[model samples]
Target: MQNFFPAQYSTLSAAALKDYLIKVYQLDPSTTCRLLIRNVSDTYILENQTQKYIFKIYRDAHRKCDEIEAELELLNILKAEGNSVSYPITDVAGKQIQQFNAIEGIRNGVLFSFAEGKVILDLDSAHLTQLGRDIAKLHQTTSSLKLNNPRPVFSFETTLFEPLKDLKPHFSEMIEEYEYLSNIADKVVKKFEEFDTSKFNYGYCHYDFFPKNFHFDEAGKITFFDFDFAGQGYLINDLMSFLNHYFFHQLNNLISREQAEKDFNTFINAYQQVRPLTDDELKAIPYLGITFHIFFLKFFYDNYDDWSNAFLTPRYTKHRVTLIKKWEEMYCNF
Candidate 1:
């Protein structure tokens, strides 16, 4: 047999995955599997007559085995606590993660119970309130426990300073934009110093709470998924991410500033009904929001080659910086 050429990234065949999953998971022979997304990780949808599941294959560069274990551990805890989260499924051999030897190297894959329902972009008052309560309940668990394996930590060093350093080269042509990010990062750090962060609720945050990561069932129950960015951080990071939903809505003219504030406050009030948040913590959200944008900007730059080659251009970088400026202007006082 001819030696296979070395590869950086390889797309696993859906047919091969379907057959393997059927045997490992002991699924019905008639079960079908199809690729759902091919981003930083590849997502496959597997379905039989009565059941459906999401099988995700992780890229070694994006998520190491230990990090993947941590994510699965987090999900298992969430599921056990009765939180509505899509969780990993164990195979007949009691293995939650399957090892695949692809052209590049050994890749890890997991089967997740499919989150039932659809994304509701135009969330109503009840939807927002339920979402808030459920998220706070989830925090009740995530905030209290520690996982055996390690995941990312969203600190000023990781989210702000390190990203700035890593992104310096990408912004070589956009020195002004780079300076803006650096200055704002400094401001954010100083702003945090003004607050009594001792009272901030510390825990693992979803980090990407945009509506798309969650689904609303026919009865309005919400199930959150996509824990790829879940990490150790202030619990408020989840609230900040959900707030970004309204930020973009107002930015796109889908909703007025007045309505956006009203809607987000609905969520905040509901969250507080479940778990209390200090005024200082609420005040610090905008600054943390600044870090959120900068962190993702660096993510795009770093993963561009593997994730979004077409989307990460100089123009996109400048546009992202412009959006960050707008976010600061809209929310931050300093």
Candidate 2:
């Protein structure tokens, strides 16, 4: 028998939460607080008499002071450049980063200006093109600004090495599949080591650049949030992350592969307008696509419990393998 323990989350009373907000952050006492989502972090909707704000409480030990500050610094840069983003709000004390002991043992809290607009369901050519342009602008700006606080590097170790370490044990019974994946992961790591990434532009990037992470109003304006996965890494990783998600949806039959291909072309073409990808960066995309596959494999391990009923089973292994094979066939050859 194995011992399985569910994670326990600390809670705060409504009164206590309101008091903390008013006293610590100096918000209006009459403000109404409501829970939003409690997945990676505990997010809340903070509504005052006139305005709204996003209250994010980092999970215990999930992030440190420097990492949060790094994100805020990047946001400040984006805001200063007249880029539309969910800028972090300064408290009454003029401090944006606030950490204090709360329902969670020790949580880091940040307040962000509420972003207006809604998720785009219908992706028109113009919408997709504008998105690509905005992404290019983001990359161009961040490429020049230097961050004093270190953002975690999204490299082979975090995405592949650590993930394979945790996963090999879970699926050890399937010797052939496990070993095959192990070899593929090893090759990806070797590629990372051999490639001179300096040839391609690299900078602070949102590793989770997907549609759900931002908002698009009618005028094609974008207000992005959720810097939880933001880190210093190759810019291509961001593009591939979006592509991987779209490709996964395509595989699931939610969208046609042709549509996915069109989106990819549209995004890349628009991106080229502001900051073009070099021939070297384009060549590196396939290898990075393999890295994307490795990232996807690790997601199944982390979220298996959440999707076990729907897909994470023996089918999960086959699904991962199929994705790897599919990427290899589609990209590696090109």
Most TM-score-accurate candidate: 1
| TM value for model 2 | 0.85
Candidate 1: deviation at residue 331, Å? 0.7
- Alpha-carbon lDDT, every model: 0.94, 0.76
Q: lDDT per residue, candidate 1, 11-63, as tens digits?
A: 99999999999999999999999999999999999998999999999999999
Candidate 2 pairs with clashing backbones: none
lDDT of predicted model 1: 0.94
Tens digits of per-residue lDDT for model 2 on 143-174? 88788897878788877777778877767677
Stretches off by above 4 angstroms in model 2 are 1-8, 13-15, 23-30, 189-196, 296-326
- The C-alpha stretches of model 1 lying farther than 4 A from their native spots are none
Looking at model 2, report the run of 10 residues with the lowest lDDT sum.
Answer: 3-12
Q: Per-residue error at 209 for model 2, in Å?
A: 0.6
